[model samples]
Target: MNLKDKAKLLPQSPGIYIMRDSLNNIIYVGKSKNLRKRVYSYFIKSNNVTSKVEKLMKNIKDFQYICTDTELEALLLECTFIKYIKPQYNRLMKNYERYVYIQIDIEDQYPIIKLSSEIIEDNSLYYGPFINYNRIFKFLEGLNEILPLIKCNNYLKEKITCINYAMGKCEGPCIKNVSSKEYKKHINKVINFFHGEKDLIKELEKFMKEYSETLEFEKAKIFKDYIDVFNSVFKEYKHILRLNNYNKFIIIDYIKNSIFKVIFINNHNIEYVDTINMNNMDKKDLEEYFKNIYFKFYLINNKESKNIVTKEFIDYVHIIFSY
Candidate 1:
């Protein structure tokens, strides 16, 4: 049978479909609650199909699927397959290690703002899996100017003050001009700022106004740049902050055909996944089941491994978090 005829034989169930070229190499992996509908859609021609999809479809010589109990399982399985297979058609979240973040080394006696490419298990605070490096870099640069936190990498080694300290832009922690306690207070403000509790933008605007009123055009321009970066990035940053807050929680989702899925999350990693059939249990039994699983997993505090953000895991997180 041809690929189109073969797709028609697929079951209408939650599963992932693997598409292959004539060379019998798996080129793409996709999932759907209804395997037949999704697989069939790819075979049928449409003018609205994207160039990428058109190219992918043209190369498809055959396909197959792995049946899953729930859509969540299908999603997770798709992430795993794509990560291991490294299919050419699968693009997004593939290079997750390249994702950027704003790191605050809170473990240090004097914390400083720095950009990081990955998240690790440490005492430091991380602010993103931000995609745009230039934008985040600009925002961090502006933030360093607005906040009197440390700026130099040599702050721990050098006993003397730097250019930023001389210009009153740094608290001079390296020279003992600011105590760790006082400097950390500034770090707390930055933490609150990312959590959407503090208004750093308002302060930047205030400084901009003051410089403008005093006719210090050069200084005013600097503050204006900071305010502009904040305005552009803060909204998305707030959304990211909320997404990151999906730590240590349980997600119960009802799948079709009387199936319910329970996901145990800890520090953005899925600790466990289980499914129960509503048809098999009564109300009291369901309640007892939930209670058992809840107490079994919820009360315990588990530390995420240092290398928590795997490519597959990141895609899985995005799928469930968005759901």
Candidate 2:
């Protein structure tokens, strides 16, 4: 069948569409809330196609699509496929190294927080590979006030008072002033802040108000910037924490004929994700299968699990499951 014929067959639902060239190579991948409309739009003769899309269309001989349960699922699936497939037309996400993560090495005698572009496989905690460096820096600075962790990298001498300590910024772990237990408590606070336990926004608001009252306009502005950044970043963290009441939970999404089960297990610093395929199964059978699989996995792993489901994932599940 022709491309137009195949486009007509696409379901009017959310999905990830794969466009392949004559040689059966995937050239482009895209997600849409309405697969039929999105795919059919490309076939419209009157539609203006950009140079890139024009080229993409010229090579396109066949296409396939995976019907997702919701638009968010389609988006996530599109990203996953693009990362793995490395389609020629997709350029933005090809270089994943550009992403940055905030790393906190709590294992160190004097733990220091810093930014890392690479994902390090270590015991240290990493927050994100976020695009907003300015916001991350401001947020980290605000966190420093609450946690008072060491900011320096070099090892501290026994008697020398570092500049940070002199400024009352650090807890002076190098001088052994703060006991390891006490330092650990500070680290826990920082970890908790990241996990949405402590309210950085409230702290920023308090600081901002204090500075404003004292007529420290510059300082108040800085605090205001931090507040803005925290508001944006914390929204996602808040969503994750909402499901923290559940030690372990399963989110099942029935997409077209396939059932996608996302099993989330939350441990100390890592969130483990396992996907189960329960295609063409009844709800009762699916639940039984999930229990069997979850028990065996839990017994083998023996780790604490929590419901850290992403807002997008949960929101999409609600949309698809509602139908």
Candidate 3:
């Protein structure tokens, strides 16, 4: 069938579309709340399509789409497909490998915190894939003042001492001054601080005030920069922490004749994701199925759970509540 005919048959629901070229190569991938409307918009000559889209349309031969239950699901699926397929016309979020993560080996006798660009399947706690490495490192450095952890690579060694110990910036794990248990307590505190259990902003404010009182303008300026960086990165960290409070929940929605389930667990971890086709079920049945599952998993009466749900899925819920 021609592109126009195929587009006409598209379901007016949230989904992702894959556009192919004459040789059947996947060239473009996109998502839309209304697949039929979005796909047809491309074929409209009067539509103000960008130069990139115009060029893409010229090579398009055929297309495919995976229906999703919600626009959020469609958005997430589009990102996954784009990353895996590496479509020619998709330009954003392709270089996910370049993103950085802060890795801490909690299993180690004396855990060391460091930056990582990849999340290996080690039992370590990984903090971020933050694009701003300098800001993150600076924030860590500032955090060290409030909650001191080891800053040296050669920790837990016998008869070795570092300058950090002399400066009182780190507990002396090198000289057997800090026991593994004692050091682990500090490490746990650092973890808690990262999880938003403690307010580092207050510490920053105190340090800034001291610097200014001592007439150390240089140090004051440095703290000011740290404050800015921390505030910027903390927003994302705060969101993840909120999601972590909910032990488990399933986000269910219907696209066409299929049900999509995205199960989030262990705080912000994605436990399971799948789509089930139920061609026999109608829209009313789908809504009933979703409500049954949602109420079973979601504790609406619990005030804390509601707050966590509100903060965690604020973006998705805002769109839903507004409608």
Candidate 4:
């Protein structure tokens, strides 16, 4: 069938639409709440569409859709296909290599907080797959200022001291002024802060207020920017941690009166999608289905590590986390 003819066959439901070129190679993958309306829009010529979308339409020779019970299911499936297929026009979430993480090598005598694009097997702790490199860099800069952690690279080097030490800003690990055991306390506080235990926001706010009262406007503004960056990034950091704690969970999305969309997530992976027609099933049958899912998936595939966010699935998790 022709492209327009195929589009007319799509149902009025939430789903992912795959656009293909004349060569039958997938070029674009997109999700929408209404498949028929969304797909049909492509055929209905509109000048308002972006140059990118117009370009995408020019290459499209065929299209297919996977019908979903709910928009959420469509979103999950769309991410799966985009990640695996790496479609030509699917731009977002494709550049996982550019995602930056705040790294801390606790294995070092004096660990330095640094931004890393790649996660290795080295025993360091990695905190993010954050997209904003400049924001993270600023947040870490302000964080090191408040925490008295080493901000200099001269640590364990032959250099006696740096300006940070002269101003009593760092604990002075380079000069052995603070032993590894003592300096670790600061790192532990940072770890606690990342874990959502330490209330650094309040403390930073206090410093901001103090600087403002003393007429140190520049310093106050500096702390203000720190707080801004912290607020933007830390919430997502905590969210990833919470999500990684779940090895398996079921998201039951109510589509209508008697239809439900069931998504089974295991180990940051969407394992299965099941649609249920509750028009015939009784309460007891519904309860049994949930119980079976809980026991079969949740109990058997419990999360092993609460803190570890694997670098491999960080981008995948980002897609779900954003949704």
lDDT of each: 0.79, 0.69, 0.71, 0.82
Of 1 and 3, the candidate ahead on TM-score is: 1
Candidate 3 colliding pairs: 244-267
Arrange candidates by lDDT, highest first: which order?
4, 1, 3, 2
Tens-digit lDDT track for model 4 on 101-147?
88899998888888898878799998887876778888888787788
Question: Could you give candidate 2's per-residue lDDT for residues 1-323 as a string of tens digits?
Answer: 88898899899999899999989999999989899999999998865678888888889999999986656567667766776788999865555545456777888766777888765668887765454567677778877765578776663655666787888877777778898788888777667777766465777889899999999999999888877877776764454444455444444554544546363433312134344556656799878976776776556656654333322234323223332
Model 2 earns a TM-score of: 0.63
Worst 10 residues of 3 by lDDT: 306-315
- Per-residue error (Å), model 3, residue 207: 1.6
lDDT of 2: 0.69
- Using TM-score as the measure, the top candidate is 4
lDDT of 3 by residue, 113-145 (tens): 888876677899887656556777887887777
Question: Candidate 3 deviates by what RMSD?
Answer: 7.8
Candidate 2 clashes between residue pairs 3 or more apart in a chain or in different chains? 100-129, 247-305
Which candidate do you rate higher for lDDT, 2 or 3?
3
Q: For model 1, where is the 10-residue window of minimal lDDT?
A: 303-312
Q: What is the lDDT of residue 114 in candidate 2?
A: 86
